[model samples]
Target: MLNKKQTNTIEVSSDIAQVIQDGQQLVAYMAKDGQVSLDPDLAQVMIDAKYKLQKKQWNAQDEAHFLHSYDQLAKAVAPVSMESIRAISRSDNDKPSQAEKAVAWYRRYTLVALICLLFVQVYYLFGHALAHDLKDLYESRNEWHLKLDSEEPNSKEFKQIQSKYEEVGQRLDANYNLLKVWNRIWLMGFSFGSEIPPYSQEKLNVELRRLERAQADANALDNLNLAQTRLTARLQLFENMLFAQSVLEVLQGYVLPLLYGLLGAFIFVLRDLLREIRAITFTTDSEIRYRLRLTLGALGGMIIGWFLNPQELSGLASLSPMAMAFLMGYNVDVLFAIMDQIIDKLRGAMAANDGSKGKSIQGSGNG
Candidate 1:
């Protein structure tokens, strides 16, 4: 039958009682270790707070007095121990502040964003694998064409090369079919106004048919070469299109770097959050600051990718662009420091150039 206000008061009272109990236990341990000797006035406040809590006379004012006394008592203990006690108090309290609720929401949002980035990375990996397979197929087809050119028509070696060429062609057709479907899905919105026209399955089929006919005729070397040339050209076009899609559609300059940066920031924030929670130093302010840090990290990653060449950095020359972006995002300060150094060096070089120019002018005047 408790009203909302009464229910909240009851909850607050329970939370205060738990905090006071924990404080008392910590104080007792500190006393045993000769690290604390509570003031008489603070001791009396604790006694009164306990008596009121036990008698169900607890109220907001009593809770405040209890908290103040607990703080004063804890001041004598090690800072780390005090923070641990506060952390426990916050953890036990069921009611959260509005800011804490907002932080919780943002934390979930960051996690979701990270998961989306992971999916994109996996998709890119699949595309890269497909591209590699296509490259190998193209090379195999080229090798067969070379063998076909050198071998005499209708000979056993020519027949063997022709059979292998047909097998490679079949594999290319299957791969092209898969690529078309993958392109549609992967490049859905990004494929508009592309210079390379959509590869026609009909054209591919016709060329394949002509190649088959030439193979059957055996003596039609000109027809065989023409069909092989057309088929190879078609495959090369598909390879170029796939490469463009990977570069322009999937990994548009800043998109991957931004995602990598965000992932790095998320990791750093998550680690920091855990550490702060353990130290009982996490607050609404810290949560808000972390949100801004995440943004800066993403931006830092993109900037590093755009402006900072990995080759210019001594030890970091081995890192890929994406890897560099991640590192920049995780610690934007490093990027900033590097930028500062570059700026300073540029300024120094300019100053030296200006000084030399002035000396040359002075020498000419003397002459």
Candidate 2:
């Protein structure tokens, strides 16, 4: 047992086996825990050991041994990483103070309330602008008072008034100056021009002449039928102008704001998802999931902006886009939680209703 050659041979084999075991442990730990440390000689020895292992036909026991080591490494590191991500400290694990809980709740609820207020404001501003536009249109049209309220339509006085109205209408149509008006509208955002005559002379002439002959009696002249014709003309003019102004208002109040919010939402979602993937899975590529989250966030923001009426809330409508952006960025999880609760309630209600219906049907059958 003490022969020099045999003793040296045994020592060399023991050293080789130690090197192999160390290399295996190092690689398994590094793979699972994302840590590495090596000197040049040690690194070389690990590489050589790994190469030798690869050449050998490993048994099930060999595979199990490596897997077990990996599992141990993962378990050791996972809690630390998770705790770091979640911001859970030793104090948090213990009983939280009432003051600490209150502060946390205050922060969350205050943010939610502000977001809701911002939504209200956006809708209010949009609605206020629209209402103002409509009001102006109504006042401007009413000032025309184009109806010839005089009793005798065939009289010289009535004819003279009618002729003057026609002249003004014709001049307005001919001198519309489309380029000038369009430039003004583009620059100023809105306008009401008399270029498009609210009432057509041909229709006015026919209605006036018809009413004059058919409703010639003193009482008939006072009847609302004559006034209805003038109202119709006014309505047509208002309809045309409202259509144009509505398009402008919608673009400014809804479309542009929604686009800005969407852009903000997309960026926020992408960044958050990328950070999550990096921290948790490190090697996972989540481009599709990121894009999907971005799209949903953007669309959700748009829907919130759409429902918030600016006119009703007036000054508050100014905050709509900002609120929507905030909602997309931070409040999305809270919103989803709230939505889940609502859905659950609705499902319960529906089930209850179905049960009631079934009971009623049974009672009816017995009766």
- Give lDDT tens digits, candidate 1, residues 33-101: 434575778777777766766766666767887888788776766454643444334344577644355
| Clash pairs, model 1 backbone | none
Writing each residue's lDDT as its tens digit, candidate 2 over 1-367 gives 5465333332224544554565555544445644444334444544654564655533344444544544453454553242232232225558653323433543454455446546645644544454455455455433332544543678887677676656555544332333234334334865444342445555555766886878667765555455655566555455544554665566555554455445555555445544543444321133344445555655555555544444555764666565655565444554466457768999999999999999999999999
Which parts of model 1 have CA positions greater than 4 angstroms off?
1-93, 97-103, 189-236, 239-253, 306-318
Q: Relative to the true structure, how large is the alpha-carbon lDDT of every model?
A: 0.71, 0.50
lDDT of 1: 0.71
For model 2 the local lDDT of residue 218 reads 70
Candidate 1 C-alpha error for residue 288, in Å: 2.2
